[model samples]
Target chain A: MTANTPPKALAFDVFGTVVDWRTSIAALVGQVLSAVGRPDIDAFAFTDDWRMRYLIGMRDFGQTGRGFVKLDILHREMLDALLVDMQLDLAEADRHTLVMGWHRLEPWPDSVEGLNRLKRRFPLVTCSNGHIALLVNMARHAGLPWDAILGAEVAQAYKPAPAAYQRTAQALDIAPGELCLVAAHHGDLFAARAAGLQTAFIHRPLEYGGAPAPDLQFQQPWDYEAGSLTELAERMGC
Target chain B: MTANTPPKALAFDVFGTVVDWRTSIAALVGQVLSAVGRPDIDAFAFTDDWRMRYLIGMRDFGQTGRGFVKLDILHREMLDALLVDMQLDLAEADRHTLVMGWHRLEPWPDSVEGLNRLKRRFPLVTCSNGHIALLVNMARHAGLPWDAILGAEVAQAYKPAPAAYQRTAQALDIAPGELCLVAAHHGDLFAARAAGLQTAFIHRPLEYGGAPAPDLQFQQPWDYEAGSLTELAERMGC
Candidate 1:
């Protein structure tokens, strides 16, 4: 008898795995900073700094155990603080418009094509730390046709927590074994695997600024590792 | 000086309002009953019996106040219980497939076109008691392009609770005034208004079966009322 392993759903890690967040944010920050007469400012650094506060804001809520703040709000909070610290003065309306840059992120080259192919074979969705609104807006802007959008904001527990992954399967009414986590980050796949989900590692070597690094190599322990989502879909026999 | 109204995000009620749940479930029930040689079975009674348990399941979860459960899971529980009471026997695989019918409900005739028009100018999303995954799957199945999906599952509280609408706005990072609850049910809009949201009542008369008595007739102090989403979209200038 063939022990067929069927994944009821495939959940993706969005930031670097699906969309090039580093490059996308850098472009947006560069445009905004240049417009505001700060041409020499390090846009990449500015983006990274803004994102660093993301975890901190979530941790504040996690510690208080009172409220769950969506990532878009947390991003805005961080952006406001960072702008003040960087000694920049911008109008309220302009700042609000700039904050929406996250909604306009460009998907990677293979994202749309690969996702469409995979969608024919499995239920494809996002399981990311980004809030539902952010993911939805990003999908709309990028023209990504996702079956569903799942996020930590819905679970109120960020990744690396089993609750996040387990809750996704529970919400979909699929068993953990019937779900696969597709991510570029080893840590994310490790967390998903620990939660009983199958893992598919996608290599996004340039995720941390297109610099050469050791961790980008395909990890063998993963059930599947591919150079890109195109290869991943092909390997999945989509 | 311009007297500016607050930005409004349209929060829709799913289930019977957007989709003809009665017809969908009745068809499926009839099909299953006929296939099982129980041709004379009362499908309407079965559908209602299955639906009544929905609120009971939510109330039970609320009563326990422990971990949360999604609507799909709750529906499965109810379906299994009802199937037994109806003296029906279904295979495990068939039972799973039948439970997934919620994910495949068709939209009302005006749903897609109306939502598309409205979405051109407004942030449109679901504010249903169903879980995020349930709503998302339904959207994909029905070709309903929602800008975002919000639900009582997000707040761990069901409709009629103020927290449901309040949490939806918080998740979107929009003020309560910016979220207008668009629903057929008076009680849902009443709860939304109580929680400080704008209210638009759409007439979905056949939600509970037969010709629905016009519940919110004669304007009723709402921001707007329309016969269908097409009319609603025109009123919103979309």
Candidate 2:
């Protein structure tokens, strides 16, 4: 597929591509730590650690198809385990609030406008690993205009699984070739490409804070590549 | 549930309730008949007959639970059977266009504005028998502002099945009691209520044209009842 001929729909990876989960999580963790009288705790490290645990969880799910659980549940479970490891005492309400923070993650600066622009031409949907509730809440909170929510919850399978990409395209009633999976991660794009869907890579240099960034350079050929979602929209003639 | 306490999300019945499917289908069929040199065909009767076949298809699926097929496929099958019965000849492209008419159904006059208003307060989603793609396309065509698309495809079960309502509520991460199912059809509302969801009835007297309308009077107690979706929104204080 050529960049000149855009796909009918663009399915986005929400966590790092559309929403700045690292910064949002760190900010939320900072507030929680301060509220719990532990302002000295490194919120960024805590956020990174939590995210690492989530990655491990996804990896385990990919390796072992032991049924499916919503990402919100997994997030809460990981949060509880992290609290135990950190030896922090939090009230049930506070724990619930912190665990629900995933639902309140802020979108990247370019996300709302870029998506709105893209939406004028093509249907925009989230093809993330997040649960449907999480995607709905986050879109509502962040003012992201998604035509539909199609993701791990809708597919009953996590990302990197061919079913995820295939099911999303099926839900849209489009051939996999007519759907583009937009993400900042190469692994996601690679998997989407392998699933016979077009891929777009948007550079998110600050996705991991100061940690070594994923290779921003296009490791594999994709249908479209842009420095940011705004650039992506511009390239797509939105 | 009381009228004063609104649900977090409103799951709407799209076909006859939110969209004027009968009129839209008749109009499309009229165009197709004219194009095919069969303008003498009664488009309204054809529409009704096609709808009856669709209901029969749903009934068969409900009784069999053999698996699930998207409504688009079912509509195509029913259309083909009807064409055979009528001895009408149409080009493959015309047949495809006629089948695709389901995606172009017009919303009721109050649908767009009322949904937009309700959307400001509660997430508005479609819990229709239509597939996700059908709902998405219809929303886009008619400018219905749906937050997400959840339906028989998502649940892998047709409406009136407990699993449909239950799965929609589960997908929203809300208890069935906290998800309101708004429809003009009593059976759908009753099924939703049986599944523990709140119910709202909007009177759509013209849904079936000159054919006698379904008993408009609320046979059983419901959480909310209104003359139109606009009135429903007003009653809900949206």
Candidate 3:
């Protein structure tokens, strides 16, 4: 967090940080819906609802002392509830396909190039709440060049939980200050900073895809701030 | 595993399978010894002794309910005992340098190219007894392009424990048969077979530095056997 001392490793927050979950999920869901005879349900609205429940479910689960469940399982539970509310009866395989959509989200356009650039300088790891398998699948699907995957699943805690930030540093065998969390969400940045991790804010204004929530606004000063990952790479001297 | 069925993912045993650890550790230790005025110590013998205790310590720790300790801590413990046995007192930094040698071990000559070739076809993950930080550092040092790092550390159980192999399969969301254990040691491959996972063997003859202990020899019927990782890649049709 100090000016002269640079972070030895950079931890990334995926989903809205590296990948475009909103548009990718909306498109993938519509295709699945078309195949499954449920094209009437709005894909974008469904994506919004699913995305909205993410942090709340994870936090509440941890708060209620439910020890670390993978986000994939949580997503499936949420999807099943939504399906029940809509009076939808889906095949098991179709339900699985819908849930597996999280594993195949597309990265932001600048993600691949920017990550490659930063990887050349510092070790790049995933600090997202997305579990290791989902992160790995998304990286392969999106061509994101992550050096290592560590975060919620590895730490057994979701972001904003101090354990998510601290345990990641422990996993990497680095001091919290030596690991920088690069995230589009202000809350994640705030949590990282509070956990003694260096913080970098990435502006992803369209993360909600014109839905007007403004998920990536720069709310406060961070160690570094940039409009895109490429800009972050440039600012970090990578 | 059935011959007709191909594994969905490849999990690698890193130390001897992917890296020339004996040579690397011997060289690194020799350098440290020479720098610390203990040039008379036998580096190869030291490396061999240190490596010889690896599996025993891991197995005993688990059986004795020590839980899953990271291999780095184990490595440090082994190095300290070896130091005491030799009556060699080293500076804290020099002692750390010797243990960190694991993180900088060189891969076999054929490893990088073969891994790059195989990585194109399968998601290559580490199934080594080494922990995540050790694996990540080694991968970076050796230029191994691993999709994810898992194994004893991630599973919190050493190899030969069914939990190690089963947990890795579960983490990838694949059936046990869909995961292949690619290792040089017969014991490791045998355990994988027992755990309902596929197995492949790659020869690494000089793993112990030619002190009359043979390694990397083709021993038995495996799902696949090859002279090198490149050959393994070819056998897998990668």
What TM-score against the true fold does each predicted structure earn?
A: 0.82, 0.95, 0.93
Runs off by more than 4 Å, candidate 3: A1-4, A36-41, A214-218, B1-4, B211-219
Model 1, CA-based lDDT: 0.78
How much DockQ does model 1 earn?
A: 0.41
* lDDT per residue as tens, model 2, A36-141: 8999999999998888898778856877757678887788888889989988878888778877899999988888899999998898889999988888899889
- Using lDDT as the yardstick, the better of models 2 and 3 is 2
Q: Residue-wise lDDT of candidate 3 within A72-188, one digit each (tens)?
A: 888998988887877878889988888898899888889999999899899999998888888888888898878788898888888789999999998888999999999988878
Question: Residue A126: error of model 1 in Å?
Answer: 1.9
Candidate ranking (TM-score, best to worst): 2, 3, 1
DockQ of 3: 0.70
What is the model-wide C-alpha lDDT for candidate 2? Answer: 0.87
- Model 1 lDDT per residue over A48-136, tens place: 77766664554355565655456666677788899899888777775776678877788889989999899878878788988877887
How far out, in Å, is residue A131 in model 2? 0.3
lDDT of candidate 3 over B19-76, digit per residue (tens): 9999998998889889988889899988888887775676566567777888878888
- What is the lDDT for A218 in model 1? 29
Query: Which pairs, if any, clash in model 2?
Result: none
Alpha-carbon deviation at B220 in model 3, angstroms: 3.5
